[model samples]
Target: MVVIGAGAGIGLETARQVRAGGGQVILVGRNPERLEQAARDLEPIGTATFDATDTDRLQRFFQDLSAPVDHVMVTAGGPFYMPLANMDLAAARRAFDERLALTLGTALYSRDKVRAGGTLLFVGGTGGRRPGVGMAVMSAATAALPALVANLALEMAPVRVNLIAAGFVDTPLSASLLGDQLEARRAELRARLPIRRVVGPADVAALAVHIMCNDALTGATYDIDGGQQLLPH
Candidate 1:
C-alpha cells in the first residue's frame, strides 16, 4: 500500500489501520523529518520522500518502485481557506498544488504501481460536494477529483478507484488552520452535522481502510461526513 502525504492525522491513522490488516505500507511526503518519523511510527513499513507537486521527483519516485503496490491512498491535498477577494497568487498556487495538481500527479504516477484488483482512494472534501465561500479553490479541486477518479476506475478496469468525501474532520491540519479557535469552530460545525458531532481522524481512517480492502466497491464516493453534507445551510 502507498499512502501519499502521510503526516500527523488521517494519513497516519490510515497507515495504522492498513498495517493492522496486514498490509505493507509505504508512506510518501515532502517533509523528510516528518516522513521519516511517520515511517518510524508505522515501523517496518516503507517510506518515500517526494513532493507531489514536483513532477520530476514524483516520476523518479514511481520509477524507483521495486514492485507493484496494491493500494494507493492519496491524502496529498489540504484545504486552503481564504476569501477569493483576499487570496493572492501564491495562495491560489498552493490550492492548485494541494488539490488539483497533486491528485493528477499522484494518479499519473500510481497508474502503473497499482496492481490489478487494487484500489486507489482519494480523500475529498464535504464542502466540495456542497460548495461554500471562503473555501473556493479547495472545494472546486476536490469536486473535480472524484470525476477523475471515476474515469480512472473505468480506464484502469479491475483496479478500483474511489473517494472518501470527509467532513469537519478534527485533525492537526484543521487545528493548524483553525488556530486558537479550533475547538470553538469544531463545536459550531458539529452542531450542523446530522450526527451532531465532529468526526475524528480514526473515523475517516476506518472507512478508508474498509474501502481500500473491499473488492466490489469501485467508482464509489463514500460520504464519511457524519451526514453533514445531507443537511442544508
Candidate 2:
C-alpha cells in the first residue's frame, strides 16, 4: 500500500489501520517534519516527501517504486468553498486543477504500478454535494469525482478506483477550517447527525481500509458522514 498525505488525520490513521492489518506501506507527504514523525510510528516500507499534485513528481514516484503495490490511498488536498462573488478565479482554478490532476495522475500511474485487482482509493467529501451559497465550485468538483472514478475504474480495468465521500471529519484541517467555531460545529454534528456523535479520522480511515481491501467494490462513491447528509441544512 502507498498512502499519500500520510502525515496526519485520515492518511495517518489509514496507514495505521493498514499496518495493523499486516500490510506494508510507503508513506507520502508534503511536510517533511510531519512525514518523518509519522514514519517513526509505522516504520513504513519507504517514505516520500512531495506534493502529490505535481504530476511529474507523482509519475516519478510510481516509476521509482521498488515493486508493485496492492493499494494506493490518496488523502491529499482539501475542500475550497466560496461564493462566486468572493471567489478568486485563478486560485479556484488552481485548486480544482490540482485536485483533478492528483487523482487522474494516480489512476494513470497506478495502472502500471498497482497490481491487478488492487484499489486506487481517494478521499473526498459529501459536504460539497449539498448546494449552498459558498459551495458552487466545490459542488461541481464533488459531482465530478464519482463520475471520474467510475470512468477510471473502467479505464484502469482490474485495478479498481473508488472515492470515499465523508462530511465534517474531526481532523486537524477541520479544526483549522473552523478555528474558534470548531467546538460549536462538533456539538452541532453530535446533536443533529444521525449517529449522534462527531465523525473522527479513525472513522473515515476504517472506511478507507475497507474499500481498499474489498475487491467487490469499484467505481463507487461511498459516503461515511455519520448520516450528516440525511439531515436538513
Candidate 3:
C-alpha cells in the first residue's frame, strides 16, 4: 500500500493501520522531515518525498514502483480558509488546482499500476456536504472530490475507488488551521454532535482501512465525521 500525504495526521495513521495489518507501506509526502519521522515510527517499506502537485514526479514515482500496489490512499490538500467576503481569487485558484491535481493525477497515473481488486481511496471533508461560513473555496473543492472519485470508480472498474469524507478530525493540521480556536471548536462539537466528541485521526483511518479491504465497497463516499452532518447548522 502507498499512503500519500503521510504526515502527522490521518495519512500517517492510515499507514500505521495498514502496516499493523501486516501490509507493507510506502509513505509519500513533500516534507522530508515529517517523512523521516513517519518512516522511523511506522517503519514502512520506504518513503517518497515529492510535491504531490508535480504531475511528472508523481507519475514517474508510480511507474518506477517495483510492483503494482494493492492500495493507494490520498489525504493530501492545502489549507484554504476564509469567508467569501475576504476571499483571495488567486489563492483559491491555486488551492483548487493543487487539490484537483493531487487527487486526479494520482488516479490517472495509478489506474493501471494498481492491481485488480486494489483500491484507490481519497480523503475529503464534510464541510463540502454542509458548507458553512469561512470555508467557501475549500467546501467547493471538497464537494468536487467525491464526484471525481465516483467517475474514476466507473472508469477504473475492477480497481475499486472510494472516498472518506471526514469532518473536523483532530490532527496537527487541524490544530494548525484552527490555531487557538481548536479547543473551542472541539468543545462546540462535543456539546452538539451526536458522537459528542471531535473525530480523531484513528477514527478516519479505521474507516479508510475498511474501505481498502472491502471489495464490495466502491464509488462510495463514506462519512466518518462523528455525525457532524446530523447537527443543525
Candidate 4:
C-alpha cells in the first residue's frame, strides 16, 4: 500500500491499520518533519515527503516504485471553503486545480504501478454536498469527485477505484480549520448527529480498509459522516 498524507489524521491512521494487518506501506506526506515523526511508530517500508499537488513529482514517485503496490490511498489536501464575497480568486483556482490534479494524476499515473485487483482510494467530503455561505466551490467539487472516480474505475478496470466521502472528521486538519471553534463544532455534531458523536479519523480509516478489502466495491462513493448529511439542513 502507498498511503499519501500519512503524516497524520486519516492517512496516518489508515497506514497504521494496514501495517497492523501485516501489510507493508510506503508513507507519503507533504511535511518532512511530521512524516518522519509518523514513520517512527509505523516503520513503513519507505517514506517520501512531497506535496501531492506536484503532479510531475507524483508521477515520478509512482514510476520509480520498485514493485507494484496493492493499494493506494490518498488523504492529502483539505477542505476549501470560501464565500463568493470574500473568496480569493487565485487561491480558489489553486485549490480547484490542485485537488483535480492530485485525483486525476494519481489515477492516471498509477495505472501500471498498481497490481490488478488492487484499489485506488481517494477522500472527499459530504459536508459540501449542500449549498451554504462558503460552499459554492466546495459543492461543485463535492459533486464532481465521485463522478470522476466512477469513470476512473471503468478506465482502470481490474484495478478498482473508489472514494470515501466524509463529514466533520475530527483531525489535525479540522483543528486547524476550525481553530478556536474546534470544541464547539465537536459539541454541535455530538448533539445533532444521528451517531451522537463527532466522526474521527479512525472511523474513516476503518471504512477505507473495508473498501480496500472488498473486491465488489468499485466506481462508488461511500459516505461516512455520522449521518450528518441525513439531518435536516
Regions more than 4 Å wrong, model 4 = none
lDDT for model 1: 0.81
What is the full ranking by lDDT, best candidate first?
4, 2, 3, 1
Give the Å shift of residue 193 in candidate 3: 1.4
Name the lDDT of candidate 2. 0.91
C-alpha RMSD between model 2 and the true structure: 0.9
Residue 35 shift from truth in candidate 1, angstroms: 2.1
Please give the CA lDDT of all the candidate structures.
Answer: 0.81, 0.91, 0.88, 0.93
Give the per-residue lDDT digits (tens) of candidate 4, residues 1-233. Answer: 99999999999999999999999999999999889998899999999989899999999999999999999999998888899999999999899888888999999999999999999999999878888998877888889999999999999999999999998899999999889999999999999999898899999999999999999999999999998888897
Top of the candidates by lDDT: 4
Off by over 4 Å in 3: none
Ten-residue region with minimum lDDT total, candidate 2: 224-233
Better of 1 and 4 by lDDT: 4
Looking at model 3, report the run of 10 residues with the lowest lDDT sum.
126-135
Which TM-score value belongs to model 4? 0.98
